[model samples]
Target: MAKIVVLGAGLGGVIAAFEIRKSVRPEDDVTVINENAFYQFVPSNPWVLVGWRDREDIIVDLIKPMKKRHIELVVGKAERVEPDQKRVRLTDGREIGYDYLVIATGPELAFNEIEGLGPKGFTQSVCHIDHAVQAHTAFEAFCQDPGPVIVGAVQGASCFGPAYETLMIIETELRRRRIRDRVPMTYVTSEPYIGHLGLDGVGDTKSLLESELRERHIKWITNARVIRAAPGMMTVEELAEDGSVKQLHELPMKFSMMLPAFRGVDAVRDIEGLSNPRGFILTDKHQRNPKFPEIFGIGVCIAIPPIGKTPVPVGVPKTGFMIESMVTATAENLGQILRGEAPSHEATWNAICLADFGDKGVAFVAQPQIPPRNVNWSGSGGWVHTAKVGFEKYFIGKVKAGKSETFYENAVLGLIKTKKIKAH
Candidate 1:
């Protein structure tokens, strides 16, 4: 019997373990390793920062679910990956052997890339539950004495959705508290434009987001590179299309939330031929490392190049739907290998995103996440907000039930023509 190990228990890893259990032989051993015992819904982090949701409200204890599914769970951070020996070393000095390994550790937040940034620094973050809780506390303090606010993603940052959602959500809360008029808000982003979103403007996202920002009286500086951030002050350099600095400004702010760039986790960072220079897992179309065929990667931990060139580096985002697709394909391929058959499954890698902005939101779908695609669509309304809420409930429920796919969820994705895997 093959021993299959899935790393990280975030959205992709948890679902992957469940799918692998369903596809592999009954005797096959499936184990999941994660640093945390609880599965937190990352999409709801923006809500948590605004006091709309609490930390406990969005997390599920993984122990009960893993026990119910008969999957082994190890709560420890991976220290190193011995690809040649097919073993993973945990921080506790225990080594786990596996016949196959799935790497879904997600990105390691690169806050040190910039000075005085991140939760430990001057800026706030909503990327993780802990960060969101801290941001919530900062927001509470800021509300008592509102001032200028800075919100956007830093250069080389790929995850733009949370930056946008957190910005708008903070705005909504300020208005609710009747202190919006007392606060001046500015958006600073690395994207060449407001809605490039690292996918080169998804179906008029440029126009829609620009309109929303204008209606809300929020000013913005595109192609911005944050030089440094100090307490209550951030220096930004606005660049022109030709890569020349157009202007530099020292913006004062009582609160800030700038998303940092991401890199591969420590365990896989120095593994030659397995990761890119940025430390993201290098995988082929089948999500398997060409050098280490026994290893498969999914989620934000995998490297995807930027769609095109911009003044500042902006990596493409791995949305939830796209990551789920990768998880399904990886599980299927691993199952084929266990049966001594050649793997022949590929993930669609399609992008379907719902960015909630408090009362209203924007949703987009790109058939092939990398442009020049068959379908590209986007829309905005209150329904998107409602749909996002429903998604949170449904996804968290799935994690607790130890189920990967559901008929209703599949039907809805079918209506949108999205699939987790495509046989070729």
Candidate 2:
């Protein structure tokens, strides 16, 4: 019997385990290794920072769900992945061998790359649950004494939605507290434009997001490179098209949250032919590592080159639907291999997002995530905020149920898609 191991229990890992269980042979052993015992809905982090969500609201204890599904849960931080040995070594000196391994460890936040960036430094971060909690405390303190606020993604950062989400959500909250006028906000991003979003601005995101920023009286600095972030001050350099510094600005702020660059986690990085220079797993379209077919990768941990050239480096975002597609494809391919058949499944890799602005939001879907494609669409309204909240509930429920989206739920998603298009 093949011992299948799934590493990391984030969005990609958890669903992968549940779906793999159904696809693989009954006798095949399915185990999951994660650094934490509970799963935090990362998309809801911005809401948490404003006290809209408690730690318990989005955190799902995986022990119960994994047990219910009969999937072994190994709770430990992975030290390294010995691909040659087909085993993963944990920090506690324990090791787990496997016939097949799915690496979904996600990216390691590269806060140290920039001077005085991150929760430990001058800026706050919402990349993790704990970080969001800390950021909330900072937010509360800032609200009591409002001043200039800096919120955006730094250079080389992949995920840009949360940067925008956190920016607007905090803006919405500050207004709610009647302290908005007392605070000046600036959005500093590596993207060439306000809505570039790494995919080069899906549909009319450029116009929509720009218009929204204008209506809300929020100033933005695209192609911004954060050189240093000292307490209550950030040194920002705006880049020209030729990659030269056009201007430098010292922005004063009482609160800041800059999304840091991301690299591959320590566990699966730096092996010969196993990963790229950045430590991201090198995988074929099938989501299987070329050097080690038994080793598959999904989510932000996988290597995807930047979409196009920009003044500053901006990595592509692996959105929820895109990662979900990767998970489904990998599981199906693994099932084929186990059944002694050639795999013939490919993920759609559609990029979809619901960028919530607290009370209202923007929603978009890119057919293939990579540009110049069909079905590039985006829209905005209060409906998106409601949709995002509904999705949070639905997804967490699925995780608790130890299942993927059910057939009925899938139909509901289809209906939602129809409604979104109509609203658009």
Best by TM-score: 2
lDDT of each: 0.90, 0.91
Q: In model 2, which regions exceed 4 Å deviation?
A: 406-419, 422-424
Question: On residues 208-243, what C-alpha lDDT tens digit does candidate 1 reach at each position?
Answer: 899889988999999999999999899999999999
Residue 219, model 1, lDDT: 95
**lDDT for model 1:** 0.90
State the lDDT at 59 in candidate 2: 97
lDDT of 2 by residue, 334-369 (tens): 999999998788888787788999999998877778
Q: For candidate 1, what is the TM-score?
A: 0.96
> Which residue pairs in candidate 2 have backbone atoms (N, alpha carbon, C) closer than 3 angstroms, thus clashing?
none
